[model samples]
Target chain A: MEEIKEIMKSHTLGNPVRLGIMIYLFPRRRAPFSHIQKALDLTPGNLDSHIKVLEKHGFVRTYKVIADRPRTMVEITDYGMEETRKFLSHLKTVIDAIHF
Target chain B: MEEIKEIMKSHTLGNPVRLGIMIYLFPRRRAPFSHIQKALDLTPGNLDSHIKVLEKHGFVRTYKVIADRPRTMVEITDYGMEETRKFLSHLKTVIDAIHF
Candidate 1:
C-alpha cells in the first residue's frame, strides 16, 4: 500500500490533460501537437505545459517537422508508455482499496 | 467538441489526487478528511487544498465535527458526483476519438 501510494503521488502524469495525451498517444504511438490540442480540446498554451511535464519526466519525446506548416510532433517513449500503464494501475488499486 | 473542451477545462476535479478522492467518496458518499488523506496518501496541506477547490466549485460540502478529536468530514454533493461522472465520460470520449 505504501509503495502504491508513493507511485500514485510521484507520478508525473498527474492531470486529466496529460492522461488524455498518453491515452491518445497509445494507439498511434505519435501525433502532431495540433491534433492533440484539437482532440483534447486544450489550448495551445495549456497543451504545451502538460507536454513539457511529460517530456521532462521522459514520458514523451517531442520534435519538430520542417513541413509547409512547420508542425510539432509528440510521441510516447517506451518508458513513458510504461509509466502511463503504472499510473493507471496504481490509481485503480488505490480506488479499489478505498471502496466503501 | 468545443463544449466538451470547456467542461474539461473548467472542471475543478482536475488532478489525480482529486480524482481519487471522488472515487473513494462515490461508494460511501462521505468520509472523514483524515480517511481521505490516508486513503489517497496525501498530506494534510495537500488534501485541504484539493478539498477546498471541490467545495468552492459546489462539488463537495465540508464540515467539522466538534468531537474530542475535532475531525473534519467531507461529502460529495449530488452535483459533484454528476460532475465526476461527466469528467470520466468526457475523458473516455477524447481518448477514443484521438485514437491513432
Candidate 2:
C-alpha cells in the first residue's frame, strides 16, 4: 500500500478517461479491447496507448484472441488491484484531511 | 475523494521529491521553506516550483516570517489533505489488482 501510494503521489488522478478505464477493468475479471474503448469514449489509438502503458508497468495483462478476428482482452492482476485500492484509499485520506 | 481520484488517474506519482514534500506537509501543521528543502533534498528553485504547483491547486498555504531572516512557512490545506489521501488510496488499489 505504501509503495502504491508512493507511486501515485507524484500524479493526481485528473483524467476521468483513464480513471473510467481503470475502474471498469478493476472489478472485471477480464474485458475486451472494444468493450473498454466503448466504455471509455476513447479512440482505438488512445485506448491502445493507455493499455500499453498499463501493460508495460505489469499492471494489466493482454491476451490476444487468434480467431477469425483478432481480439485483445485485458485483465487487472493482483498487483493492479492492490494499486487500485491503495489509490482510492489514499484519495479518501487526503480528502478527509482537506481543510474545507 | 472521487474528484481527487479522477484528477490523479492521469498521472502516476513517481517523483520521489514531490512525494517527500507532500508527506512532510501532510502531517505537519506548518513548515518553513528551508525545512522542507533539507528534508526533501530539493533545491530552493525546485522546491519553489513544486510548492507553486501545490499552491495553485490550493493544496498548500504559505506565510512569510517578518521577524528577521525572511522565512516562508507553508501549511497543507484540508483540500490538499483530502487529495493526498485519495491519491494514496488509488495507487494501492491499482497495485492490489496486479497479477504478480
Candidate 3:
C-alpha cells in the first residue's frame, strides 16, 4: 500500500513557515528575506530560523544581493520544489482517503 | 510575531498519517487499527510505523481488545488533542497571513 518512501514526515518543509515559504516561492520562484517576512507576517527571527533549517536541508539556498545595501535572497531549489510537491501530494491523498 | 510557543513544529502530529489519525479520532475518540487502516488506505506496515512514532511521542495510546478476536485500538491523548489543535491553529494563521 505504501508506494513512496515512508519518511515524508521527516521533510523540513513540514513546518508551517516552511510550507508558507514554499507556497510563496512557488509563484515568484525567488524573493528576498524581507519580502517573505512581510508577506508571511513572520518575525525576522522566526523566519530566519525556519529558512536556516530549509537551507541546511538543501531544500532552499540563500545568497546575498549585490546592491546599494546587501539583502538576503532565498529560493527553493529544484529538489526542494520536487520534495514539497511530493509532500503536498501525500497530504492531499491522506485527506481524500478520510473524506471518502 | 511569536506570541505562542515556538516549538509548534516539534509536535509529532505534523505527519500526515498522524494528522489524519487525529482528525479521524477527534470525534470518534477511539478506533480499531483495521478501521483506520481501511479509512486512510494506508498499508498496515506504513500505518504501524507512523502510529509507533505517535505512541512514542505520547500523542497516542494503543491497546489490545479482548473480543471474539483480538484486535488493536488507538486514540489521541489529551495532550495530543491540545497540541494538534495548536498545530492547526498555527497553520491557519500562516495561510491567513499570506492571504491578507
Candidate 4:
C-alpha cells in the first residue's frame, strides 16, 4: 500500500490517459502521435495536453519525423521507462494483495 | 485503455489510500479501525479522513462494536467490492498488455 502511494505520487502518469500512453509506448518505445491518438481514442487537443505533461516530467519527448509528410512522434525516455516499470510493479503488488 | 479510463473515473477509489483501504477490507469484509491503521501504517487522523471519503461514496460503512471498550469497525459494502473487482480487472489488462 505504501508502495502504491509512492508510485501514485508520480502525478503525470497517474492519469489513465497518460498511463495508457505509457503502456502503449513501453514496448514500442516510440510511436507516431496519430497512432497514439487513434489507439487511445483521444482528441488531438487532449492527446497534446497529456503529452505536454509527460514531456514536462521528462517521461516522454515529442518530435517530428519528415516522412511522406511531417508527422509528430512521441518517444518514452529512459527515465520514463524506469518510472513506468516501477509504477507497473507497484500496481501488480496491489493487485496480488487483493484476493477477489 | 478505454476500460482503464472508465475504471479510473471512480475518483474515490483512485486515491492510493482509499484503494488500500478497499483492498484491506475486501478479504476480511470487515475490520477494526485500529487494525486497518496498523496494517496501512496510517495515522488515526489520516485513516479517519480516508474513511470519511469512502463512507461518503458508500464504499464502506463505519460503526462501533462494543468490546473491550468501544472500537470502530469498517466494513466494505457490496458496491465497493464490485467496483474494486472491476478496477483490478482493468488494471490486470493494462499489466498484461505491457510486455515488461
All models: lDDT? 0.75, 0.66, 0.70, 0.85
Number of the top lDDT candidate: 4
lDDT tens per residue, model 4, B10-71: 67876767877888888899999999999888899999999999999999999999977999
Instruction: Report the CAPRI category for model 3.
Output: incorrect
Q: What would the C-alpha RMSD of candidate 2 be, to one decimal place?
A: 5.9
- Taking the tens digit of each residue's C-alpha lDDT, what string does model 2 give over B76-100? 8898777767665654554445442
What's the lDDT of the predicted structure labeled candidate 3? 0.70
lDDT tens digits, residues B1-100, model 3? Answer: 3412332444576555566677777657789999988877779998999899988988889999989999999988898777766665554444334421
> What DockQ do you compute for every candidate structure?
0.29, 0.16, 0.17, 0.39
Q: Which ten residues in a row have the lowest lDDT in candidate 1 chain A?
A: A91-100
Q: Which ten residues in a row have the lowest lDDT in candidate 2 chain A?
A: A7-16
Error of 1 at A70 (Å): 3.2
User: Which 10 consecutive residues of model 3 chain B have the lowest summed lDDT?
Assistant: B1-10
**Could you give candidate 2's per-residue lDDT for residues A1-100 as a string of tens digits?**
2432443442322234555566677768679999888765678998888778777766688998978899999998787777666665554454445443
Candidate 1's residue-wise lDDT over A1-100, tens digit each?
A: 5534544475576665677678778778899999999888778999999899999989999999987889999999999877776665655555445423
Report how far off residue B24 is in candidate 4 (Å): 1.8
Candidate 3, residue A87: Cα displacement in angstroms equals: 9.0
| TM-score, cand. 1 | 0.78
Best-matching candidate per DockQ: 4
TM-score for predicted model 3 compared with the true structure: 0.60
